[model samples]
Target: MTETTAEIVLFDGFDELDAIGPYEVLENAAQAGADLEVDLVTLDETDLVTASHDLRVEPQGTLGQPDILLVPGGGWTSANEGVRAVVEDGVLPDKVDACYTEGSTVASVCTGAMVLAEADLLEGRPAATHQVAVEDLEAHAANVVDERVVDDGDVLTAGGVTSGLDLALWLVEREFGADVASEVSEEMAYERGEVFG
Candidate 1:
């Protein structure tokens, strides 16, 4: 069977749960005999990056034109910066514009949806993201909603950190079948949440 490629796209100050939860789901699926391939990647020259919480990750490699591009959201508080820094930089939005096409799927978690918005992909499309980012998404002209996961065919988006797990499992169900997704969910002990279309 041909393996489906899923990339957990990372950036500096990325939220740990938003990135890792989905990654673990995909990894567990592959281990359970799913024909899937998953990796962590970034556009940066260096493989190593420091997340918002100071968790460091040396991604598997740089990105390619992946079949599934999952952008994870980070958070921020008075204590430290997270998504605010990326939004301020405005570099990643350009990269996101170049990376996606009609043939592949593009998805986001939390404020990562803002990156897609910055890339002009969310205009007139239904999407969901972290509550903190909903207004920003609407400002980007997206048809935003409050949901655990939102599926707009090739473009999928999820809310906040833990929702990454929901989106990942949903993708497994979408790519393989309900049985495979259920098995993976059971193995991971993740209760599947509502998926909005």
Candidate 2:
């Protein structure tokens, strides 16, 4: 089987759980023998990124068109210098749009959906995001769903912070197999959540 390469996009003021939850799931799936490659990446060349909760992380590499490109949201509601800043700066969204190809799937965690929306990726697409950003997502012309995860073919979106785990698990099941996803979830002692596509 071919390996699936997944990159969790990191940025300053990004939510800790939004990125790490999926990171842990995919990495565990890899350790469980799933053909997966997971990495933390920044949209631009950066040494370190400070998350919403003050956690510091060094990106493994710059963002590229991986099989799965996961974007994490932070400070969207409070307008802190994270997701909102990235959205306003516009560079990250542009890069995200450019990096997406027919061979890749773009995913978002929490308000990271806003970034996808900013890139015009979610327009008329079924998606999900943090409750706080539901109206904002709708404002972007996305068909917002209340489920924990919404998989719309090439674009996957997850609700609030912890739902990223569900998104990643779903990705594992979709790409690898249900058996491998179950193994990873069992290893992590996690119960899979609802998904809507």
Candidate 3:
């Protein structure tokens, strides 16, 4: 089987849990022999982006098409102004659009679904986001669902911040194996939750 790499996109004012949760989960999957490479990346080649709590995270790579492209959501979701500006005018949409064209698996956590929606990728797909952003999500996609994680073929979305971990574990189990995911969860001391198909 071919190895898969997942690129986690970080931006200014990003939520801490949005990126960290999936990062830890995917890292654990890699350690469990999933052969998954998790990369923290940003719009630029290298720079430190400030999270919502003002925590700085240095990205290892530039936004590149990967097997999976993950986007996170947080305080930036409020008013849709911040996220809209970035998604509509910034590099986030461009990067996601490119990945979509390449048939890459695109996933989002929390309000990150809004970013995808703004990019016109979620127009007719079933997706989930933070409960507070459900209306925003539904506005973009008519098939919005109320669930922890909504897997609509290539587009997978998780609800809220903490759901990212569950999404990552589900991805590992889907792409690798149940045994690998189980082992990784045990190693990380994370309990596996129900996966949405």
Winning model by TM-score: 2
Model 1 stretches astray by more than 4 angstroms? 76-81
lDDT of 3 by residue, 1-197 (tens): 77798999988777889899999989888987888899999887656888878889999888888999999987654544435557756568777988988988999998888888877888888888888778877877547777788888898999988889889888988899999888978888888667576
Model 2: per-residue Cα lDDT over 1-197, one tens digit each: 67789999898999999999999999998998888999999977888999999999999998877989999998896654889999999988887888784467899999999999999999999999999899999999999989899999999999999999999999999998999999999988999898897
Candidate 2 to native Cα RMSD, angstroms: 1.2
Clashing pairs in 2: none
What lDDT is reached at residue 189 by model 3?
87
Q: Ten consecutive residues with minimal summed lDDT in candidate 2?
A: 95-104
Error of 3 at 57 (Å): 0.4
Candidate 3 to truth, TM: 0.93
Question: Which RMSD values do the candidates have, in order?
Answer: 1.9, 1.2, 1.7
